[model samples]
Target: MQGFQQSVDIQSLISPLDWVVFAFTIALTAASVLYGNSLKKKTTNEKDNFLDLLLMGRKLTLPLFVSTLVATWYGGIFGVTEIAFNNGIYNFITQGAFWYVAYLIFAFFIIHKIKSYQAVTLPDLIGKMFGPNSAKLSALFNLFNVLPIAYTISLGLFLQTLFGGELLFNMSIGLIFVVLYSMWGGLRSVVFSDIIQFFVMCLGVFLVFSTSISTFGGLDFLKANLPTTHFEPLGGHGLATTLVWGLIALSTLVDPNFYQRCFAAESEKTAKKGIIISTGIWFLFDICTTFGAMYARAVLPEAESSTAYLTYAVQLLPDGLRGLFLAGILATILSTLDSYLFLAGTTITFDLLPIKWREKVSIHHLGVLSTAFISLILAYHFDGNIKLVWKTLGSYSAACLLLPVLFGYLFPGKISDKQFLFSSILGIVFTTYWRNAPLPGFYAQIDELYAGIVATSMGLIICRTLANFRSN
Candidate 1:
């Protein structure tokens, strides 16, 4: 793999037009950061505004919520970085369908539920149902489940390829650029920039696909160049591994972003509409990306898996479009990253941090400090294969949080807080021990979602039983 990566010449990977597009992206991010900083509220007393710390004071609109959802999901897993990691369309395609259905569930079932709570964080929902302690546990669980680890792993792939010999400074500059707007403006900056990024990402993918097909001469070029199972719908992961997708689809129902977007919506009707629309967008995006995997396999057989999308864009697409594609990739990465930073910051500040500290920390300061720390550490995450961490995190998500969330919402007020805590512990223990049974290929073809369902169901039963027994 290293040799294949080493074989590709960096000079061949970049062109002049790509530079202009890249520069423009950097310029735009900077401008947006400056624009967002000006929005900093002037506060007299040094105190955290609970509403601002939690739900952005519920001042969200339709477009902002919609775009943020798009950005939040895109992550480094999409576009070329995905190709770079898995090198096949299987993981990408299968996951897409799983997410599409999940998004619908989020739209109808979860979004309105969270909106009703009017809490800024998912933990807040838990806090409402159980107690502050349950909320704290939920935040800690979610802090690890996000795409940050995956993005961190892929950061190496992008920096080494995108900047090559330039090394640390290259990655640092990119991180700083994202932090500029994201750390300061918090969700406000994250959402506004994300909207633009979604468009930029779309444009980049569109141009790269068009250019690749055109350069290779036509469909015949792609068909001729493709691998044996290149266009296979399931990408070679068998029925169980693939079917497990159905269960896995439910995992996002318990995600922090899902909860956040629900809180961001102006009304139940708006949140409902926003989520339905977002799911539709996800379906289209996922399908197109699967096609992209095939195109890359055809055009750049020698290209590293991660470089598939970037390979076509940098070598095959015109320069200006190449730059746009890179910008889109950055957008995907930063959207997920900044969201985590903000969510995590809020967790430590409002949900998990001691009361005295929470009172002392201003929301703006909290956002800034947390962003800096996450960004700084994530930037240095130059080594290690990031995908495995993400997969593992997802498995953890299904195991630990899934059941508790289900119980929290569906069977609310049925169990004592202590009962819920014990159930969560049991679910996590069970998921940890048995989840690896399903491998990606033929063997343990389980979807992590079902594992989560089982864990949650068992936990719920235990919680209810305990509550019942206690009453008896």
Candidate 2:
């Protein structure tokens, strides 16, 4: 309800020890990138090089798989805290519960199928199933989905909060840091760095929640101080609004990050087990973050929801612990940022480009740099509305890709490639129209995600009927 208000002396909140810890964590992450580069095998074959760079030679161990998957999935940490601060456990239900369901769906139903495909990326898989045109269309949508704009904006906001600089300048610096490390070792670097970040992020949120309980008493304090709406199932939102979040969660079914991890896993069993294990970890982390922010809400009711968790944690944590917490937040953002940047790069080089051009040289590094530059521009353009960036882009991916990708995988030859392409285009058209154009009467209440999905489903059904009629 209140606008973000800054402390007059923001730098004073952080002690010298805290800065040391933050710097050490960042240096350690960069060191992991070098370590990943050391693990790269010397190969002149272009195909092997591509596999090594993007899929880590299809040898992702279970622990590394779990760690990377969990870390990459949770880049929008502040957005989660903001929602939890404002809406209490409802944040867990919408953001956490819905996504957990989606993860299980991927683990149980989709992992085996993905492992069977020889595709290098999600678009490659789409191309194998549908056609080149379909893959290119999906790549365009995948590029939008994996752009890292939201995470860049988050890092910018974090840096601005700490040092008080121009937001765009801070964003550029953060992007440069990620891009530099990411270019050297590719997904291996991203995964190794994620292993460190996964632990840091978990520890950071846990410390905040545990300390809050020690300082402010527990559920009793929250109950007595917070608004009743915070405890409600919908957190005072309409049913449609809550359901729209659930629909967006369906995007996980088609998420490129999930596909990449699954494709990289050494075996189908490892991928399945990794997802199952990561889901448990995610459950614990969500508890820590949601309750931690709820505690912030109770104590700092007027503080900006987006920054309340950080402000309250810094106020409560001791000097050394404060630094670790800050590092954890940065780790959370950077882990996802680098991963998405890599995904965008891979999409461009492997999925979007012609084979001859991509195979002639190592242009993956250039693609990553291009992605970072584009993300910096987009992050600045979006300003700081992380939620809007997520919802808008996420809607397009889910509405257009979910049904087609899932159904295509399940009932392989049933849907034609032309049908897949047409359905996706129809979904895009409806989503764009619903988001930008006013609808007449009751249709106005429908969410853009729903509009896109409905249109896509209709297109699929009509196409299938025509095919069947011709056969008859």
Candidate 3:
């Protein structure tokens, strides 16, 4: 119970009305996820067991699956964090849309190839092409990337700031809201919540933002307040740097979430449609959130963290509106947490744990325990994780995935076991080290992308070449 009293600084100015809005949103999200689950159960005779819990009974519908997949990447902080630091206009480029565009490119070719293999997870596909050794190693790298997860700290900071020490009840409940919902409902719960959340966040964020901009001397006020250079190309970087910025942005495509969505979908058509549509919606959502950060920059003081949109919301919004805004934030956080717990649990169960456990142990118990355990460990280890957990997710993700999925598609039989192993290793090494080139520009990202792309490409080419030579 004492651990329930964990104190972290949050910047909220929320009141009683805010609590009502949040409660309503949670109830609504819960209902939606359960409804979706019920439909799936009715269609299939699959009893609700751990395997079903682990994989949503493999009956995930098109709409809910798409919403859940999109929410996996469109985190509350992901939308709101960069707005202030980059001055809104500059950060417009770093978005989930580009990620979707990346998906669009892959959907026509790569996804079908991956699906053809009937691989349960990405590693399963790799093992078929490369070897068991590579799959095992790939899992290790994935664990490295996925482990030390964040959103806990970001959420913690926001929730603490939102309540601002007013009510003992609010802080405790808000802090555990993500951990609780995620643990209780698993992936099914997370997706349902996300459908409600994404829309609410869109509405609440737009209102808080548009209202704040109107209040604080309008558009002219922002222009006058922000540094003139804020509008400059690259913010502070130079010409070659901006070009590099454009290309490096392309690297967002080669992420784990990219292929994971394909696997998560009910069918290939739904998978393709959901991702493309989500891209557009995500773009609109990002714009509103970034504008809020820009408005905050014009009016609010510098806080302990740059990623403090919730902080601005608490201190800025009217009491009634603040409730709506906080509720939106909770919706986003819950969707993200529940989805992550499900993913994490699967990484262990489907991805790591013994398949034979079904013969000996209860799969339901295993699914629940593993999900809760990983969620708790990751929650506590939130502090020790590598760079912004998102970036770490991106980093660990980019290397392991980029090569195999693409090769598995275009040059299917060409990829050799040796090539897949070495290329992925190189990709990981380059991503981990090249991140700190000290240029304070896109060059750093460019270098990392080059490292991943070149390594992956070379591996594929070399493998195919060798295979051909041997045949000749």
Q: Pick the candidate with the highest TM-score.
A: 2
Tell me model 1's lDDT, rounded to 2 decimals: 0.64
Query: Which candidate has the highest lDDT of all?
Result: 2
lDDT string for model 3 (1-472, tens) is 1111122344334467877777777688778867856654433333345434544545557777667765666454633455444545656554433455565676665666666665555566677866876776666655544432454444554554554443333323544555555555455566677788877777777887777766676768778877765565455655543443344344444444455556656777777677667677777777777667776665553543344466566666777777778777766665565555455545565556665653222443355445545544555554523134554455455554655656655666666667777767766676656665565565554646455556666666777788789999
RMSD of each: 4.2, 2.2, 6.0
Clashing pairs for predicted structure model 1, backbone only:
17-319, 83-305, 83-306, 84-305, 84-306, 403-456, 438-444, 439-444
Clashes of each: 8, 0, 8
Q: Which segments of model 3 are wrong by more than 4 Å? A: 1-12, 40-51, 76-80, 128-131, 163-185, 238-261, 305-307, 358-387, 430-449, 456-458
**Ten residues in a row with the worst lDDT in model 2?**
1-10
> Between 1 and 3, whose TM-score is larger?
1
Candidate with more favorable, higher lDDT: 2 or 3? 2
TM per candidate comes to 0.85, 0.97, 0.80
Residue-wise C-alpha lDDT for candidate 2, range 1-472, written one tens digit per residue: 2322333345788889999999999888778767877878899888787788888999899999999999998888888899999999999998899999999998998887777677779998988888888899999999999999999988998888788889999998889888887887778989999988988999999999999899889899899989898889899999998988888898998889999999999999999999999999999999999999998888788888778888778887888999999999999998899999999998888888888766433588888999999998888788788888888898998899999988898799888778999999999999999998978999898899999999999999999999999999
Worst 10 residues of 3 by lDDT: 1-10
